[model samples]
Target: MIDAIMPDSVRTAGRALQVWDRWLLGCTFVLLALGVTMVYSASIAYAEREMQNSAYYLIRHVSFAILGLVLMVFVMHTRIRWWEKSGPFLLLLGIASLCLVLVPGINAHVNGSSRWIRLGIVNIQPSEFMKLFMVVYLAGYLVRKQEALRNFTQGIVMVSLVVAVIGTLLLLEPDMGTLVVMTVTVFAMLFLGGVRFWHFMLVLAVGLGGMAVLAVISPYRMGRVTSFLDPWADPFNSGFQLVQALIAFGRGELFGVGVGASVQKLFYLPAAHTDFVFAVLAEELGLMAVLGVIVLFGIIFARAFVIAHQAEAAGQLYSARLAQGLGLLFASQAMINMGVNMGLMPTKGLTLPFLSYGGSSLLASCMAMGLLLLIGREARAAAWGRT
Candidate 1:
């Protein structure tokens, strides 16, 4: 047993594992910290004005972040197989919660939309959690049907039916923005899973047609479409918020007025703490800071794609597809929120990922990140055979 042979494979594998783990964990903490600081800065003015306590929103956000951090650690430490195995059950629970939010006396109606469940101190938006659950569920389903995925009938029918059913519920809430994002997430996953292109196109056409019909049937939606074209036309009415958002951005030049120094938060921007938080961010932090936010999200997208590539190379197709889909979901939502704030797109009540204020959004987004971390870890383990 004294051969003293060299094992180059083991030594090289160990180095690769170390590198992956370092990159993934470092990125996770950096993103979380950025979220906390930005959320606190973005919400302070609204909190002081509305609640008469500047620390109110900050404390709540910190508490939620702590809770989310715990959940993240739990997910990261847990077995990847567990998430894959439990995907179906979680999907069922998510669907049930989504249904419960629709039932009278059980749901909380905020601003004419019944999208939450009030449980005394906390109101939970099931849709936020539903997104992560759907991602996990679809990932598992696609992997299970990898062979059948090549078949037109089974693949399109099953996938299309799920999207249609979920799309109806979200549309009934009249959450057109979220419905569109969710449809994009599912189709993105399906495309990554090797579904035929023509089938996906058929689904897209139907979805676009449905959106057009909904716009006609709903007067408010039609108004939004009109406002999108020329918000200045109705400066004092339907377009007020859009015009105000533009003003906020214009006020903030290269360098912002400084943190907690946004003028728009003084009632100029409606939904200051929620949907339009990005405008407040721009007003306070300036255009440079706004660009920074975009860049940070860009880094996240790039890292996620790296994970996907690694996972695919390792032959873990489900993890790769799920990771990629989630990256798209998070990045796309952020862009949509920012675009709406900048008046580049029609406004819908979508929160900016990570930086927006909301308990459910915070918790659900953290959970998605947890799942993302798990995928990244699995990729590392697969590539280098390390735990």
Candidate 2:
């Protein structure tokens, strides 16, 4: 208490460091730095061939990372109440960005999906921001509708419609991976907000049914399913990526081959720096390095959960829920990416968070990390008292 009598600047500095979320900030920096190093390693070969520079992807990814860090710091220092105030505006912006991506002149096309908007200097993926926007808006929405949560007709049906609208737009991107992750994040937050059991069950049933229909309607998705069931059926064709990914892990027994020494990255493993980066990581860094990555993510989740609990205990429910939602997002996306690499699940073109090489994804990851830090900051402030 005597510290309150100290100089204001020193007092504020002490308060910021003592805040509940310094650990999360530290962890995020460490993971992000590691991600930069690995992205450079995984992308150097491809960048050199395609872009005429080994540092092409690395430079771009690092640039985005820097931008993301700035966003995180800005958000961390912002008031949570301010986010709540701007919820609808953010939601509208997210939806508009999504719609713009579908526009002919604006949207950037990659592979088969038109999921980005080419803004003069950079292509922006609105869906990435939509992920966080949906989470924050949903949290605020659910909190406002808490009284109605126990109501069967008003709450349940209403939320289902909300999910349907968002799901439809996401599916239009034909990004089943992001849609699935977003669905899970929403449902989890709603469930924890006391949305009730039967409602979740009903939503799950409808969602799965919709997913099935989507899969059957798309030839490529159907091929993914078929390939998943029997990758060896078309060993040299549709199954090549999985087969190569498996071989990457098989070769990385105990110690890794060595950092940046991956043979698979020599153009054999498709998306060696993006969707299937984990496979390249396994091949180059070995099994232990892969395990290390898993461990790092685990620590991140642990820290996030701790922050959530502390925020809740400190009476900051919004901050608490925000932390939890971000944690789930991180955990779920990582699991999906890793599962695809391991062939434990059907392939979904989801980037492995910060570790993957993609501008939109990297920016989105930075935004999410920023939100997490914001929540952490509030939790810390509440824990230690305002300076």
Candidate 3:
């Protein structure tokens, strides 16, 4: 109806604005809304017991969701070239923040890991932001050294050195989960950037070996590995969390008991609203809901790759790599979280993207999605310009 009255130029401009991928954006908002609802369902009783308010976690999560959406909109409006230009500086800042979190008296330790920096009312996890920054920096690096990536000495070695340094910092915090995600993202980006097949395999082997060594050296990690292998062996201690999670899933055989009626979230399962929210979701919403959630994530991942391929076809190499990296980042984290919850992998503190209760992860995910939409827009614009 507005189109009928609007001037030609105004309509054209509006149409251009509509070029951004609405399906991707819709999937994002659906997940966000689902996250808010599930977070409330999973945390209300716990929050009331611990914080004396049933809405404590819900309120904070809503606030963060609002902030994340705003930031995402801001990123969508910003030019991608600006990100490319600032990538290095952002990476350096990320490194500095990671280092700062390890320093005495400045970092906040939770569950025996120092990974957060308290800023007045909010505690920021630098590693979460580091993932986004590393994507930006690597995208730029790949664009700058596309040809050199074919050479092991100049491309593979140099990128590995940078990743090693970052991995070292993360290991200091003992955040093996984030380190693994970061390593996989970098490797995928390098591979997509035309690095030789052999080089990619070699790096993959080294990364897996390093992670194995790290797991072996830490008793806590080794215990987690053993527990993952046989959570039933010590159901009361090391296996407690996974065992409870499995119980949640088993209880939710088909249709769940009902939303907000999860018995496990009352106290049985740990981190119900944060890391293991998916388990709570499965417990309360059932297999259908679980499959629905998986399908939603699948849509996001598939659309992201489509956008990447489109951008690459349009000669937007940086945008292509960034989009691909973002896809992998989201898919990998979600898979890892679900895998941990379902006993397929060792328990990791990785949150499900856009569906877990965490300010940093939510904000970073929104920003990444916004960047992806922007890349899709540019790809469309470039195709239009060509025509």
Top candidate when judged by lDDT against the true structure? 3
**Clashes in model 1: which pairs?**
none
Instruction: State the local distance difference test value for candidate 1.
Output: 0.78
Expressed as tens digits, the lDDT of each residue in 1-387 for candidate 1 is 111221112245335333224444555566566666666766677677779998887788778878986787677667667878898898889878888888999898898898888899888988888888888888888889988876777667787887777778887765777877787788878877888888878877887898889889999999998898899999889999999889989888888888778787777888877788778778877888889878877877787888889888998888887788778878878888888998888889888777777888878887777777778777776777633
The C-alpha TM-scores of every prediction are 0.91, 0.92, 0.96
Of the two candidates 1 and 2, the one with more favorable TM-score, higher being better, is 2
What lDDT does the true structure give each of the candidates? Answer: 0.78, 0.79, 0.89
| Candidate 1 wrong stretches, greater than 4 Å | 1-16, 19-31
346-380: candidate 3 lDDT, tens digit per residue = 99889999989999999999999989988988887
Off by over 4 Å in 2: 1-17
Whole-model lDDT for model 2 versus the true structure? 0.79
Candidate 2 lands at a TM-score of: 0.92
Of the candidates numbered 2 and 3, which has the greater TM-score value? 3
